[model samples]
Target: MFNYTMKDNCLAKKVILVTGAGSGIGRQAALTYAKLGATVILLGKTVQKLEQVYDEIIANGGAEPAIVPLDLKGATQQNYIDMSSTIAQQFGHLDGALLNASMLGELTPYTHIHQQIWDDTIKVNVTAQHLLSQALIPTMLKADNASLVFTSSGVGSKGRAYWGAYSVSKFATEGLMQVIADEYDESNLRVNAINPGATATAMRATAYPAEDQSTLATPEDIMPLYVYLMSDDSQNTTGQVIKAQ
Candidate 1:
């Protein structure tokens, strides 16, 4: 696991956005950020799930979280722009954004991948992220310090045979992170990527159903790195792909 001792209320007064915030790593990150004194915006497709996370945050005495029920597969650039505008208006600025929403298209051979699955994966994992980042960058720049963290995978840097579109999308994700980091290298905004290696999530279970999930790390286990990247402690770090394992 990535080692970093987080101080209580490390993210005080910060406004953070978390996609896929309804479950898995996103949910844990949202809860953790709220607990650390940041107001979290939970963006996910399922309304009920988002409500559950929102209730949990409030019940745990964390900040009151806002929910945005959105399906990335069908979202447009305008939708992201409007979301950014809303955030700017509501919070004045965004301190951090964790682009954790992604789709695992069928893990089939390269040649056997379905067209629709490939399209959906790329749209959700790559295009939507690109658009969202573009819209969020300006809002993030308004803060004293901002972190933009993109989720990568073990197969992002090195492609695997059966990973197919999911792997390709992650590669694009890393590239996007680098591009943004370089563009804002001298600014208050920092950009980076995190590859959560083999965590025990629904996606992981779907990818490796037969594996003993008990042996894999839980979403909470990999959060030190997640919190580090979002916190001001990593203000000088950018354009890097860090592994949380």
Candidate 2:
């Protein structure tokens, strides 16, 4: 149960993009953003899941959301360019993006990690994010206010055994957030990273099978921070990592 009071229309008329919006935290964030008055752009690899989220948002009387089914593992610079162009044409400008899509490659020792797994993890969690941000920054700059939120994990700060490429990828995510935040310090656009600690997500279950699911915080429980960072409330906040539990 998140106790933060979200003002109605806090995000009124804003255009926000959320990656990995098919399920988990991304899904919850997208729905919440819409409820607060943003026209959300749902981006994920699974069309079916995206559609399900789409229906939920519409059924709740939230803003009409657009869907973009994109596999980050295979997404190229051109793919991102096209997405940016479409967003600019359709929405005029993007006010925010929740860069929540990530791949948790197998949890194995560094020596046991497969080359393919490492490459794919980096491609999805790092390369695609970089390209997408590069393409979307221009769109964000067009807006009067903008925010870019990157997802991070505990392993990102201190490498853990058997975390492998996932941990390394999150480290890269942190670095990307800091660099972009610093560059945008003088601009209206703000960048920050969030570590959704011990959430009950499919990815978390896969990473910690022995843990009790009921003990973990649900995705909805983390929406307060997500909403705050994306909304104008955090306009002066940037280049920092916050924990959501």
Model 1: residue 97 alpha-carbon error in angstroms: 0.1
Global lDDT of model 2: 0.94
Q: What is the C-alpha lDDT profile of model 1 across 29-143, one tens digit per residue?
A: 9999999999999999999999999999999999898899999999999999999999999999999999999999899988899999999999999999999999999999999
At residue 29, give the lDDT of candidate 2: 95
Over 116-229, each residue of candidate 2 has an lDDT whose tens digit, in order, gives 999999999899989999999999999999999999999998899999999999999999999999988999999999999999999999998999999989998889999999
| lDDT for 184 (candidate 1) | 95
Considering every candidate listed, which one attains the maximal TM-score?
1
Global local distance difference test of model 1: 0.95
RMSD (Cα, Å) for all candidates, in order, is 0.7, 1.1
In candidate 2, position 236 carries an lDDT of 95
How displaced is residue 210 in candidate 1, in Å? 0.2
